[model samples]
Each structure stands twice: as C-alpha cells, then as structure tokens.
Target chain A: MKSARPDSQGHFGPYGGIFVPETLMEPLRELTRVYKVAQKDPAFKKELDYYLREYVGRPSPLWFAQRMTAQLGGPKIYLKREDLNHTGAHKINNVVGQALLARRLGKTRLIAETGAGQHGVATATAAALFGMECTVYMGKVDMERQALNVFRMESLGAKVVAVTAGQQTLKEAINEAMRDWVSNLRNTHYVLGTAFGPHPYPMIVRDFQSVIGKEARKQILKAEGRLPAAVIACVGGGSNAIGIFSAFIKDEGVRLIGVEAGGLGIVPGKHAARFAGGKVGVLQGTKSYVLQDDDGQILLTHSVSAGLDYASVGPEHAMLHDTGRAEYTYIEDADAVAGFDQLAQWEGILPALESSHAIAWVVKNAGQFAKNDIVIINVSGRGDKDVQQIAEWKKGQSTK
Target chain B: MKKTRVDQKFAALKKQGKKGFIAYIGAGDPSLDDTVDIVLRLEEAGVDLVELGLPFSDPLADGRVNQDAAARALEAGATFDGVMNCVAKIRERSQIPLIFYAYLNTLYARGFEKAMNEAAAAGIDGFLILDMPREESGPYRKFISAASLNSIVLITPTTPEERMKQIVKDASGFVYCVSREGVTGVRDSIAEGARGLVGKIKGHTRLPVALGFGIGTPPQAAEAASFADAVVVGSAIVNKFHNNPHTPEGRADAAAFVAEMVKAVKAVNSPL
Candidate 1:
C-alpha cells in the first residue's frame, strides 16, 4: 500500500503545497475537487479518451532504434516515440486533459506559460480544438530565441505575450501567467504547461501524462517479452520524466533515471542541474529543490535547450529523490548537442535538444548494461522546432 | 502570557474606538537606510502597523508598483540579512507592530524555524507570507506560535464557506480580507462586495479583519474602514516610492504620501 504522492494537503513529503494567494486558494481547491469528480465520471472519462485518441493521436508508437543499439554496442534502446504525437511533443497530452476540464468549468479562455514554445504550441492547438481563446506568456528573450515556435503558436491562434520581466525566461513566463490567472480567475483557466506549480496541477498533470508510462510498459513487455532494465527521460519541471517514470517506479528491477541539463558546467549560473546545484526551497507555489541565491531570488538558469532550462523539478521528483526511488544525473549542453547529431545520423530521428539530454545519458552509460538488457528513452518532442536554433548554434560555433 | 504585538495593537485599537491602518512598503526600496527612515516616518504619520515587504525575484501576487519597488530594492543590494538588518534598525527606533510581508519562497529559502526565530529576534512581530496556505503552513505555524509571533491568514471573496471555516480555524492574527479579486494595486473604487465578505469572515472569527489589495486613495481606505476592522494601504504608498527615484528624496516623497493616507484613515468612523 505504498503510494508516493502529494498527500491529502497536496504535499509529497516536505514538497508540494497549495502555496498561493487567497484569491487563488479557492480556485486551486475547487479545481482539485472538480478534478476528483471528473476522474470518476464515466462520461468525462469517455470524452477524454475520445479526444486523446482522435484529437491528439495518442498511443504513439514504440519504436526500436536498431542502428542506435548497434552503434552504442550495449542494451537495446527502445524509443517510446512521444515525439510522434500531433503537437510534436508530449506537452499536448497534459494540455488536452486540462482543456477538457476548462471546457467543463465554463472557461472561455485558456492561458499558459511557455519556455521553448512547445507547450505554447500544444496549448494553442488544444485551445483551438476546444474553441477557447488562448494567450501564452513567454519571456521576451525566449520569444526571440524560439521565434519559429512563437510563429507556430501564433499560427495556432494563441496570443503570444512577450514578458519583459526579471531574467526573461520560463520563470518570468510563469510569473506573468500567475498574474494573469489572478486577475481573470473566473472566465479563465491557466493551463500551466508542466508538472510543477501548486496542488492539483502536479497531480492533474501527472495523471494525464501517466499514459506515456502505461503505454510504454505494455509496449515494452510485448517488444522484449519483459520490462526494460531502465527508463530515462529529461527532467525540467519533470512532467515527461514523471509521466514515464510513474509506471516504472514500483517495478524494483526497472531503474528510473532523470537527466537534467548540465549546461556549461556546475559553476553557479552555468546549468539547470537542480539535483547538482539546487537547495530544498519553495518556488512557483510548490516546495521543491530550487536554484536560488542568498537573498531568496531565483537565479538565472542555463540550458542550450530552452525547454529544459528550469530552476525547480516537480514535487513528486523531489519526493522520489529524497526516498532514493529515482536517480537524477546531468548531461552538459555540448554533450546533448552531440547526442542530437548522433541520433539524427544513426536513427534518422532528429531529437529535440531537450530529449537529446536523455539520449546523451544513454550513450554515456551504454557500457554499464548487458547486450540483452533494454533501456527505453522517452523522446519527448520532435526536432523540427529545434533545427533553426541548432543551425544558428553551429554557425556561432564556427565563428568561435 | 506574552501577548504578541499584533494582539496588543488590535486590543488597544479596539478600546480606542479606532479602525486599524497598516502601511506596507518594501524593506530596501532604493536603499536600506531610507527603509528605516520610512518606517519611522510611517509611525509618525499614524500608521498603526507596518508590513515590511521583503522583495523576491518573482513576486507573482504584486502589481506594478510593488513589483517595481521590489526590483529597485533588489537592484540596490537588498538581501535577506540586509532586510532583517533594516528591521533591526527600525526596531531600535520604534516599536510599531512590524510584520514581514513576504512570499513563501523567501521565508522557506531562509529555512522555516530559522526564519521565525530571526524574524522575531529582528523585531518582526508577525508574518503574512503571501503564498503559504494554511494546509502547507503547518511547520510555519508551529514554529511561529511557539515563538509567540502572530501568523496572519489571507482570505478572499471566492473562498468557499467550508474552506473559509477551515482557514479561520487556524488563523491566529487578524484575517487579511482581499478587497478585490486582483493583485495588489491602486484602484479608484474598492470591491463592491467588500462589506459582505468582511461580514462573512466576521461570522467565522472574532479576530479583526483588515481589507487590502486596491485600497489606494484616502477616500477608498475610509470606505473600506466603514465595514472592516482595518484597511490596508500597500501599493499606493509603494507607488509613491515607485514613481520617484529610489533616493532619500523619493523616500521623503513617499513618507509625505503615507501621511495623507494616515490622515484619511484616522478620519474613518470606527464601525468595530
């Protein structure tokens, strides 16, 4: 009867809480209550399932990377192809679930915070499908670096607001989104794109995204006739990693590893390696490990992949890390770029720089596994959104 | 029993047939010395209590004025120790009931038990952490209550009746009744529903309820005091400092602005 979760008050051990303003406490509590009712409603379940299959193109394939296994000379790497999902990232799964709830709540607008724009695109896509107005708050700097995603999000009918606040990154984006939610709580639903934030958000997002792990578990059993030896995914706010890892945490034989962005190195502001540089503190509502300074200001984070650049991980991840249920490690930005190139060359699959973090970990530790052992990597997003940035990065490197 | 400063102030205000008025300002707006100067000036201006806002990088619940003041403080070398040091200076000069108006991350980052002890030792009489809800406030409440510091709770218009009961049950100091359904800012009119919300909270707890968030002008604060036991003026005072340069001149300007607000608050008929 062991359950690793956010408890009744939405705490996962010392992490996770409804740390919000009084204006938001009611909404968070209400959302938590409604989400519980929605879970048991047969009609609600049917509608969610229908949209998951028809609208989002769910049950994304589990592909075996034959060439990658041969090149690495280790365990068979099974790719749980989340990149094949309709919005090109696993972000769509959570967005679709939240959109359904928004519709039920009679919300007319759906708002979100985006970093690399994958979540914005996914949120925008779901908003369009649900015929709800969408606004996305992104850091001004992020909007510039992720211009293509900005365009894609705009094209999908979301109003992309450039936040010119502190640090101008995902952290600021979230702050802006929270401000928006506080002002327009009645008619709006802030579709937080990750498995962070306060109560119900972490729980709701994890439940929606558990499909990845559930699907991969059945698919892996069929492909290898047994559970994989390990499961790996990149951890930002830890949505995708938790999505895949939730299904495997109980399986004692299955090793769960979350790869964090190592950026340049562990020199203070050089990385988003929360496990390496973070201290246990609260930020963005939930109590988790955070990269903060002595003055309690959240420090600027660095990751070549915009999506993986975050100061904190999910509360559940904090709990897991504390209990020794999951091991989190780091992959530097240069190594992730190298992994991106390797995946493209070997498997003809250009991985998103975010997902490439997991791939980098896979290649670095391939020697640790046996030939028959299997390791499944959750390729969280397609690389079309990253190609322009990657090309620009290469140009900058050549000039150097 | 060592009556906490918050309780003593409310009781005295109650006996005097006066409505409470708490003035909020960032601890290091422009510089720490100005902050110490401003709090002392605020006491002279008739502010019953001072809520010294400790700035954080991400102030999610603040409006532009408060946010800008925080930015200025942070830019001017504001740190946790620095703000606390400023509070210690203010304590030496005055005993106006002082509360550290801050976010959960700022306090939690400082460590729960340590924050309570240091806050108390540094002359903070109470706390109104902007983010930590009652459910997550167990450790915070435990530590602060044991140290005999007031742990104020925030209540809003949207709070369900059942949840409000739960929130007030654990509430030690007065409940902060949000005057409007928005972040902290200056508004021409208070929430039209302010009176009813105050009445609802009054039914739940005997602790004095202070309405804040958008109670900007003197008339607005007066209107709010007509119903609630206290009216809070934060952003408007912060706005005075916000619009001016973060200098001694700016601090003087904001202090003058707070004086006007105090005059108006002092004029309010004490319904309590």
Candidate 2:
C-alpha cells in the first residue's frame, strides 16, 4: 500500500521540503532518485533484511514491565527492548540501511554528525562492517560528556572531529558536518543522524526505522490480544518516536504520545521543547517547529540528555502535532533523572537518558490511564554510555 | 516587472563598457553604523553594487570567514530591524544598488511578504537567498516580484545544463555563477568550471552573470571579470580588515584594498 504523504516533492503537508543551496540540490535529487529505485528492488530488500536480522539482531523483544506496572498502579506498561540490539541502541537499524544504500550509490566515504555519540558509534560500526572510511563531527561539550561513546567510535576506526562553534552542541556539530559534506560531495555520502534534514532524508530515515513499530504491533496483538492503548517514545530529532508511531498511525483507537525534554523549566534557553516554546521556522534543511527568538535567531537549547538537546524537531513530528494525531508533552531534567533511576531499580534495565523522558512522563502521569490500560514505551538505548555523566550529576545534586 | 536599481546599475555598466564590481560585507560586523561606513567606502572605491549579508544563526552555505562575520554581527546586536535600519541609513547618503544575501528562515520568520516590503521600503534593491532553490522558490518568487524587488538566482558549477534552464526561467536582476563547487570562501586560483557554467547560464537567460565564490584576489577578480559581467569579492576583503580598529583610518584602509579590486575588474574590457 502506498502512503499518502510527502507527495514526491517530500512535503508532509507544508513541511519537509528541500531547503539547501544549489551545490547540494543535484546530489540530493540523485539520492532521492536512487533511493526510490532501491525501495522496489528485490535484491536490495533481501540484502538489507539479511543484514538487519543476522548482523544487527532484529525483532527485539517486547517485555512486560510487571514491577513498574504494579508500582505505577495505572497502565500495564510494556517496554520495547531496542536496547538489546547490537550496539545497544535503535540507531543501528537506520545506519545499516543507509550504509547499504551508500554502497549502492557508488560512494566510498561516510560522514555523520552526532550529539550523544550513539549515532556516531552506529555509523562507525556500519562503515567498518562495509570496509568504508568514516568521519563523525561532534560538539566539544558533547565530546566531553559522552567521552565513552566518542572512544567507542574511534575504536571502531572512525575519525571524530571536535566542533567548537556556537554552543558547542548538536546544532553546531550538524553545521560542521554540512561543511564537510559540501567540500567532499564527490566521494562522501553524508549519513544524517536523524529524521530532520531536507526531503528524502526524513522519509528515508523514518522508513528504515519503522521496523520497530512493525514488530511491536504484531507482538502486542499476540501478547495482549489487542493493541496497546498508548505508544510512547522520546523525541530528539524524533527518529525512534516516528519509527514506532508509523505502524499505529492509521489505528484510530491507539493513542501516540511523544515526550520532549523540558530541561530545567519552560523558561527561555532552559528547554528543548519545540512544540512547547518554538514557532514554525526553517532550520538545518527542513521547515519545522524551531526554537528561535523573535527575530529568527536559532535559540540555545538545554537538556541533561545530550541526545535530546536540539533546537528543532523532525518535520513529520511537526505535522503530527498540528494534525492532532499525537499528543506531545515535556519532561523536566529532574523528573527524567528520577525516571532513569526508577527504571533501573524496578525493571532491572538501564535506559538511555533520552528514553527516560518518555518514562518520566508516564511516571508523572500515572493516574491518567486506567489500571487495565496497556501502554508501551520504546527503550531507545541502554544507559551504559550515560553512567558516568549521571554519577557526576548525582554527586553535584547531593552536594547541593 | 519594473526595472530595479540592480537592473539599472548592470545596464549602466554595460553602457560604460566596463565590468561591475560587487562588494559583500556583513551588516553590523562591529555595529550597524560601521556597515554603513563600509558600504559607502566601497561605493567611493568604485563598487557598482553591494550584497549585504543578513546574519543567520546557522549558515550552511557559508565558510569560516563569512560565518565568523555573522557571529560578530549577531554579537554586535544585529537584528532584522537593525539591518533594515542600516540600509535606510545608507540610502540617506548613497544610491548604490544594494541586495540582501540571506537564508530563507530570516525572512520567513518575519513573514516573507512583510519582510520584502519592509526591505524595499528601506531601499534594498534585491535578494539572493542562498538556500531557496528553484523547486522551492514558487511562493518566494511571487513575493519578491510583488514587492518590486529583484529575485536574484544562483547557478552553481554542480548545476547541470538541463537544471540551469529551469532555474533561470524567471530570474531577475543578475544570475550569480558560483566560481567553485564549495561554499563561500577564498581559493588560490579560479576554477576552470566557472567559465563553462557562465556560458551555460547565458544560453538560458539574457540576464548578466555575476561570478562569485572563491574570487578574492585582485587578479582572480580580474580573471573572473574577463568572462562574466560582474565580479564579487567577499572573503578576502572581509579577512583583510576584519580586525582593524573601527576608525577613519580603518575604513580608509578597507576602501583602499577594495579600490585595487575595482581597478582590476574595470581594466578587463570584453564584449558582453
């Protein structure tokens, strides 16, 4: 069945059109054309499926969090075990797909921009598996906090370039990666880390990630004999959220919820909640809800989770918010930390700080759902990468 | 469409049988007032047109030099209103053709029509939005033409001949032919692909071509002017006086450097 969105020009309603310079227009067009062809090729599908199932370990489990469900005393919570995947995150799913497409496009080198460094590690893994040269741009601040992931990327044989531009965060890293891609368009394929860039990218990344939803939908039906009342995921650039939401979009009875980083509070410069504090504007390459001031200068964003620290959300998320298909809300840093600790102690599973935002929302709103209601939260990644950062945060909190 | 100052200046250059020299400077580099001084100084040094860069938070098409200039501008309190006010002040002294080199978000945030109207009211002659390609320029083109401002289009070395035909269909003012495949920066010598790109654009539209990107030195500017109708020098001039004291001597020194570029471009006599 053909989906009704993106209209060939890659617009989801009024969002997600190409907004890059003339130098990249031709290359983007070529990529779009090539991706369209690859989607229908049987050999392409067989190769991608083989790698995803055999190498990356597809069909991650859907475990019922009985302790959390009993303690919360509201919804029956089910956690999607994406953390069980190879590399301990869901990012490998999209990276492996793009790497295969890159090989098909006849390009050699791979470039990426990372925030918490999960995407960088995933890209590096794929590049090494495929015997391709890889480079990743990461903000200086992120490189300091997510040092382990940075080392992991280097250990995978990827060159990590530290970006020291504005705010020294994900936004600046994306800017640096774009500069590199512009300079090396001939031999390099930019493996965008999120579902937020110009056309074809948002669509391409979302399609690659939809496997999470496809698996969860079937698993829930067999496990519970019905669809979950709500499906929850955290929104960074919204790749995983859109991934799980894509399968349930047409199910009218199923509610989709996306949680954003509320940071310290709703105050300006203290949060990364685009739907809460942002207006519709163009940034990076796509038109979407962006955190900006009155004069359109992109605002600085703050999140305890480096993965969720961004000024803009994906364009499709903007469309979903406007069309009222999904309910969006924010989770503060303190609450997210609480969620992180709660999930570890109660469920015996460590979740990435980014995924804790979704858990935080459910913990804060436990009374909103009925006790029989089934709700699934996507465990996007494991917390092994965030252990030191959270330990330091806890030490500082105790001192305070 | 009515002839804008940009069109008139290009026609005037054609009549004088000399190539045009276009100068680019970030508004409010140190302050908005200093931008006025720079524009007037470049005008006095024989610049036929000026491309005023509107500061954006994330400039994907710019290199380190232009990016740093934007950072300085934003740090010096450069806003949309401040930049328009600077243009109004320049109109108080000179009539040199002026255009905005901007990204789509800066104007889209203020409402494209309202932004264009305000700019035209403040004496901006045209716009060269770096990221708005032909496919996404439908409504933007209408807004520019409705405001009676020239919608300047860019044709890069990577743009194929078939795509170039579609890009220059309704292009006004003059076509900007990028001298290289990369973002805005300085290079050692002119790329051989620039001449072919210009020739291809000429086949599509009668609009005068202005070659930019990496044309920073006087000899490079002269070489670019040998084939194109205009030569745009941005990063070299920006890097030259970027750290000078914001005094009369500083403005004069910047103007002296630009004057050498003007002399080089004007010395190139070629049939258009």
Candidate 3:
C-alpha cells in the first residue's frame, strides 16, 4: 500500500506549505517527517485509537431526524454526532492528536487562540491530560461572551490571557498567539484551533482531524447501506467541514456543501461570509480569501456565533472552492436562528450556533432533493452554551 | 530653498547637545481630528520627531496595544487619503519633523510614487515601512530619495553584519535599531544586545541611530542615550490615549505623559 504521507512540502494538492516564520521552520520540518512516521507506527495509532474509544467517546452516533425529514418532505436527514465528542466539539479530535505529537516532539508548553472558546477548552483539556503547561490567548470580546469557558480553562490550569487588540476578537487573538510563539518558539507548540494559519498547521490539523470523515464514511455506509447524497458542515476556519469533506473529496458521487455564517445579511461589510464577499488576500499567516478593506486590512467580521465570525476561510477551502470540488453557501442570522429553534423542538438536538449554519442551509434547501436522497449534516457542536443568546433573540423577535 | 523643518529640528537638537525624542502615534486613532490634536500636542511637548503610524490591521511587528490602536484608527474611517490629509492639516499649523511609519502593504497600495509625492507635499520628512528591509529597499528607496524624503531602516539585534552594512548604506536621516526581536512596546529596560547593535551601526555610518522598542522610563532612556543619538518611545506615549479622560483633562494627562518622558530623556544629557 502507498504511504499516506502528504507531499514533501506538506501540500494537499497545492493547498498546504510552510508559511511560518523562520524560527518555526526546523520544528515544522521535524514535525512533518515525524507525523509521517507516527502515522504508520502501530504504537502511535494504537494510543490514538485508545483515546478515541475510551477518552473521547468515539463512534459517535448517527441519528436519523424523522421530524426534519417529514418537514422537508424530501430527503431524509441524518447527523453525525461529533457534538458528543469530548470537550463538546470536533475540535478535540485534532487537539488530542496534536498534543500527542507535541509530546513526541519534546515540546513542553502549548499555546492556542480560541474564538468561541471551543478550541481553547479542547486544547486546555488535552494539555492538562498530557501534563503540559497551557496558555490560551482569547480576544477580550470573546472572553466576555464566553466567560464560563474562561473559568473552565483557568480551572484546567491554563492561563487565559484576554487580548484587547485589533478587533478584540479571534483574528487578533491569533496574532497575539503567533507573537507569543515567535518569542517563545524554543519550548512551545502552537495548537492552532482550526484548519487555517500557515502551511503545516492546516495540513497537520486536517490530517489529525480526518478521522471524522474516516469514521463517518464507515458509519454512514453501515447505517444507510450506501453513501449519502450530500455532506454538509459549517465553515468557520473550515476544520469540521474539511474533516468531513476530505474522505468524500475523492468520492465523485458525494456532494460537499460548506455553509458560511451570513450574519445579518450578505451585505458587503455586515457578515463573515467570505465565500460570498471576500477577495484573495493574506491574513493570520496564510494567503486565502479574506474579508478585508481595499488596503488589505482584515475587516471586523460579525456573526451570531463567535466561532463563525472569522474574516477568512481556510486556504484548503479556498483551493477547493477554486477547483470546484466543493460548493459553498451562506446562512443568515435569521435563518440560523430558525434552524436552531427547529433542531431543538423537532430533533431534541441543540446544534452549535456555528453548526446551525449547516443545519440552516440544509433546511432551506431540503425541498430540492428527492425523497430517496439522503443528507448527512455534521452536527459539529452542541448549543447548550448559546441558550441565553437564543432566548434573548427570541424575546426580541416576539417584541418585533 | 526653503529650509525643511526636519533639518531645522535636527540642527537645533545637534546645537543643544540633547538627543532627540521621537514618539510614534497611529494616525486617525480614535478619530482623525483627535490624532491631529495629539500630534500637535506631542510637538508642543518637545518631541523632536513625530512618527505617524499608518494603521494596518495585520501589523506583524506591533504588539497588541499598537495593533488595537491601529484597528481603532481604521474603524474611525482613517484611510490613506484621510491620513495624508491629516498630515497636511498638521503641516499648515506646525513645522515639526514628521515621518510616516507604516507597513509595506499600505505604501504599496497607495503606489510608492504617489505616496512619496503626497507625503513630500504634506511636509512629511521620512518613510519607515516596518516590514521592508534593506534587501527589498531598492525600488522604495529610489522613489523616496528621488522625491527628497528620507528612507529610515530598522536594525534589530539579530541583524547580521552584511545586512547591517546594506541598511546603513541605503539609509538616510537615521537608522532605527529595534531594541528587541518583537514589536513595539514599553519594557522594563533596554536589552543587553541594544548597546552592541548601536555600536555596530555606528561603525558603518555617521547618520543618527535612534534606539526604539521597549524604551519606557527616563532611566531606560538615559541608558539608551548613552549609546545612540536619539531614543524612540511609542507605546508609553500611546498608552496615554488608553487612559485619557477624553476631556480637556485627557489632553492634559496626555501632555503630562509626554512631559515626563521628555524629562527622562533630557535628564540623561542636558542641553549645555
């Protein structure tokens, strides 16, 4: 069998490369070589598999939404319950894998940036489990909104520094984390939260998280006795979307749809819908489609969900978008709100505000497919944390 | 020929036997009108050179404080045209030496020739594109020098000998030797590497070498002045905006910050 190692430079068909600072070049090169070796090492795979089975509660269930199917009056809707994974999202899968890699590489500290606090919580959990010192940088705004997560990370013995610079959000948090890594490059490994950032990060994070698709493929085949007609996931930095799409990218029969947060609307400056309004530019150490001003200053993006408010999508998403291997769509705040309430009332599933974008897209387009066609939405995270926001929005809706 | 204000200011500093104090502030921060007020106040507070930071979102070399200030400037409708117009307005009132400090993308977006021409017309004296170093300075230096504006280069402690030689050869006005590897900020003391970096730059050129990044206190400024001709303080001065009361009291507070920083610099080497 051919080795599953990525190309020499870590490219997944011109999608990945080492776009990091000079300080990280050697470590990243070492990591690239070691990751290839580790993938084949039975010990490493066994350890990873053990964690997936026993720790992260892997083989997450595939639930068929009967009410959703009846409401759609078309395709049956099924969801891959990545939301049930340890740390409440698909992000932990990659974090756990990377943390193991960090230990193997002799790194003693972990640093990361979090938007909705999902990645930060996941990283903090992994670091605590691996007995490493963890430092997470979060935007001041996110720190305020995700106060519970801040306490959680601190309780886990990770230092949660509130970044007040730039837009006081995820992008700025990443900048501060990168600055920290650059200064402390000798002993630290930056656990990037998404399938973005410089070259090896996108590739490594994707490879580690590809277990989602691998598991989903087998589970879906076993559950449905065939491949689903469509696969859907929300795209923030496109991690979960890529995780689910990677296995199906080569499967020409499967249709991949990535949903972006449309915020209030797809107006030029209102939303974080990069696929709809962004142009090719560089931000957060990678060249990709970014929502920026004419001078290339990354703009302040808004979304109901903190995780989906990034101004740029992942570079792999950009390449896949350009190549037409995947289709991208948008879900406005109103649509996502409806989807959030609908998923809760109909399926007893409170999807993450980020993942709700995918749900919203599926709901809006449900009528287009035939009754026999099946759509598998990656329920990327649970929405228990967003209850307050949803309740406030509901009150406002009633008042209006 | 009309005497350029920068030359006049430099000559005065040279005569006074006092090292110049250069302060950087993001143009159009908070608001463009307020930035103009801040600039004028900084000039009045005995700042010799004012470096106007052109706000860019991804300022790779700036710390969080400066980066946030840049974002506020951009959000307040500060554009390239708006910044140049602010410079022109300040020129109409004062003759202080002004330098446009920015990332290369801003300069590239405005087109080098257009930026230089507009800058010269607005009484701007120098250019410090933070990310562009000596190797990539050819095209920018040609246009800036041709337009009679100085091209200032940054020298870090990690900069090697050959690169230092190139920087000094291409540099005009002064050489800004960053005290540390990271972005601009106020730190406790000058790095141990700064003195040696200053000595290396002095070996190459007679142009003034200003030590910047992390020079916060009078004692630190004094220590830096012992080696270089000028001390650059940015974050300490910008921090004033963060704490300012946004009233006349705020302006007073900002001036006080500048006065104290200047006093510290002057205490190192008094004008004889």
> Over the stretch B1-272, how does candidate 3's per-residue lDDT look in tens digits?
24456567767777888888899898888888988888888887888899999898888678767877887888788988888889889988988899988776566556778878988987799888765545335556788987788888877765667757876888778888888766678888788888998988889998788999988777888788877888999888888876687677898788878877787777666344
Can you give the DockQ of every candidate in the order shown? Answer: 0.74, 0.81, 0.16
Relative to the true interface, what fraction of contacts does candidate 2 keep? 0.74
lDDT of 1 by residue, A302-374 (tens): 9999998889989999888888889999999889999999999999998899999999999999988999899
Q: Which runs of model 2 end up more than 4 angstroms from their true locations?
A: A1-4
Choose 1 or 3, whichever is better by lDDT.
Answer: 1
Q: How do the residues B1-272 of candidate 2 rate in per-residue lDDT, one tens digit apiece?
A: 88999999988888889999999888888789889989999899999999999999899899989999999999989999999999999999999999999999999999999999999999999999998888888887898998999988989877888898988886899999988878889999999878888888888899999999998889999999988999998988788769677789987988898999999999999675
Fnat across every predicted model, in order: 0.78, 0.74, 0.15
- What does candidate 3's lDDT look like per residue over A1-400, in tens digits? 1223345654444444444433344455566777778888999999998888899999788889899898888698999899899889998999988898888888999999999999999999999998999999999988877777888899999999998776678888888888887667567888998999766778888887788888888888888899888999999999999998888887778899999989988886689999899877546556578897777677778888889989998888888888788899899888998899899988999999999999989988987778999889999998876777777777888999
In the order shown, the candidates' Cα RMSDs to the true structure are: 1.8, 1.3, 5.5
lDDT of 1 by residue, B160-269 (tens): 87889999988776889987778888888988888999999999999999999998788888888888888899988877766877676776777777878777777876
Query: lDDT tens string, model 2, A186-205?
Result: 98999997888988899999
Q: Candidate 2: lDDT over CA atoms?
A: 0.92
Assess candidate 3 and give its lDDT.
0.82
Better of 1 and 3 by DockQ: 1
Models sorted by DockQ, best on top: 2, 1, 3
- Cα lDDT for residue A164, candidate 3: 74
Name the better of 1 and 2 by lDDT.
Answer: 2
